[model samples]
Target: MRYSPVLDRLAGLGGAKWELHVRARERIAAGEDVVDLTIGNPDVPAPADLVEAAVAAMRAGRTQYSDGRGEHNLRESLAARYAARLGRPVHPNQVLCFPGTQTALYAVLMGIAEPGCEILVGDPMYATYEGVIAASGARVVPVPLRAENGFRLSAQDLAERIGPRTRAILLNTPHNPTGAVLTAGDIDAIGRLAVEHDLWIISDEVYEELVFDGVTFVSPLARTGFADRVVVVASISKSHAAPGFRSGWCVGSREFADRLLALSETMLFGNQPFIADMTAQAVSRPSEAARGMRARFAARARYLADLLTQQTALGVHRPEAGMFALVDVRSSGLSDRDFALGLLDAGVAVMPGSAFGETLGGWVRVALTVDDDRFRTASGRMVAHSLSLSGQRAEA
Candidate 1:
């Protein structure tokens, strides 16, 4: 059966990663151990208090339908927590809760970007962004984020890409696939451009707390002029390892929040009361668990970068934050797909750079969301194979 071209456009986007992950699962099922790193799921446990809160909520019969936006208490808790984290006060009405950040992002696009409206997005962004834009019948104009520039877009680059149909710009910090955090200056420039062009800003800061080496995260909304047009989407998934709960929120002005909340209501009927309860508890406490999570990711990131660099053929973009590395494997004399598949065949798993976009074809995204020993083992094999490939090329 034939499918829509839009469906076809997404055909190979994420299938390969899971295809490899599933193959790894099969091997383990058959007693052949494999180390999988393709998925960016947190391997850590959620805070004990938060888990207890969810259990308590379940016992207290909070498993029913929640308000379309969220529970009043949860929304209020979110506003206070975010305001403290952001160093700015946010009214409770401005907080709109959803199942997760994915829903929040999709709802924002559906509510804001009209058909044929252009969204300026990063080339090697999370693939779902493309899917969301396509589902909305909007076009995504990918701006180049060169590794030479640490995978960041300059204000000039942003300015050059703006056009008549452009509706908004999607920004991800401690970026996925590369983990390149945008500097405060870069964010200021983006805000200035947003103000100058009267465009909307959709900032994804899910990895805000995962920054390392004194890297501070500043949101576009932190700027004065762009506040009205900015929509900040965040989740408790990475921060608290509660992805299963599907707890996330979109923070901004009341009008934007209301519009998105209404869209979310139509999309999901209502948020889960129990999940809201758990997330509310998480937001209220702001525990040491967040710090523990970041430290683990940072250590793994340092280990992987150091190990990969030992092999002259394997080049890794040092992860300033988050749990991933964009390792250049073209130097290993293999296409991204082949390199990923080869790793899978050798009892390892990883995501090909092409999954993000064509411009990143020479790389593979290494996820550090696994046990340290397993990650180290996989990295060693990859590096050894990469060096062998380089040696062969040199001999030729």
Candidate 2:
């Protein structure tokens, strides 16, 4: 039996990176005492009113197929929200709803790039990014997001990577694995480069609402001149604590949306109308959950960073926003996988940096979504594991 070449391109791309997280879940399900900090599955629930909205829609028979462009009201709601962020008028026709940001990204990538083309993306990106570009038959050219620069993608390095085949530059703000938010000035520069090179800018702003105090998120779309060249993919999953709902959308120029409408319809005509109804409310209002989450995540990140640095050689590359914290374990004299496996044995589970990118070797990512108590315990265990790796802690 033969399969699509895409199978090879996407082979072992997603779940493989999450293998340790999966193992942690299985062990916990079997009654193990592990403190799982592997994935950023939010600990909060969707806003109560949003849930009721979905129920009301379902009872109203919104279960039928929706237009490929998404529910009109939902698209209007998203447009209004993005209008404030982008500082411009946005039309409903420019928004295409999807099951989630992952799907939206895939559709956008397919619409913009294809075989023999390339997408310049940041290293240490979210795990599925490579697969998404590969699925579009586009090569991923990784630009280093160095720690010294706070993991913000460098526009100069990006300019160096540009070639005839470079079709686009992808941006993820409040970035995954490393929660560095790109500054406004940098976004403007990058947007200028995209304009100069005549390339697309795919901005993933799912964490737009997750940014912490004192840190602002700047989108290329917000930089003014590059509106037509920039497309944004975001979801209510992280912001509204509604991951299970799987509701998201793509925002771009009306022409870009028109060109992708055929693909959106062919792939999945539209997201569930009930889900759109729920997401409409989510997009229209400020997310109380996201505000609380930002405060909690910021405090928890500080707590864990202080704990690791004071007690062990491990130091955290403190995040300005997002649900996860990155711990640099280079002092432990072990690879990221070794450090993560050791933490699992010490009754804590986390993601190795290798899962994200090779540039992150010897680092591990820990989710800040766990409750304070469990997170504290996980912090303690991680410290002990670090000490054990340094031969400073005796095995019990």
**Which candidate tops TM-score?**
2
lDDT winner: 2
**Candidate 1, residue 31: how far the Cα is off, in Å:** 3.1
lDDT of 2 by residue, 1-396 (tens): 999999998887788888899989899999999988988888788889999999999999999989888999899999999898777899999999999999999999999999989999999899999999999999999998898899889899899999999999999997998999999888988988999999999999999999999988888887668889999999999999999899999999999999999999999998899999899988888899999999999999999988888888787999988999999988877789988887898899999998999889889999999899999888888777777677754442
Error of 2 at 8 (Å): 2.2
lDDT of each: 0.82, 0.91
Q: RMSD, each candidate, Å?
A: 2.3, 1.6
Alpha carbon lDDT at 356, candidate 1? 86
Error of 1 at 104 (Å): 0.8
lDDT of 1 by residue, 69-115 (tens): 78888888988887887778888889888878898898888888987
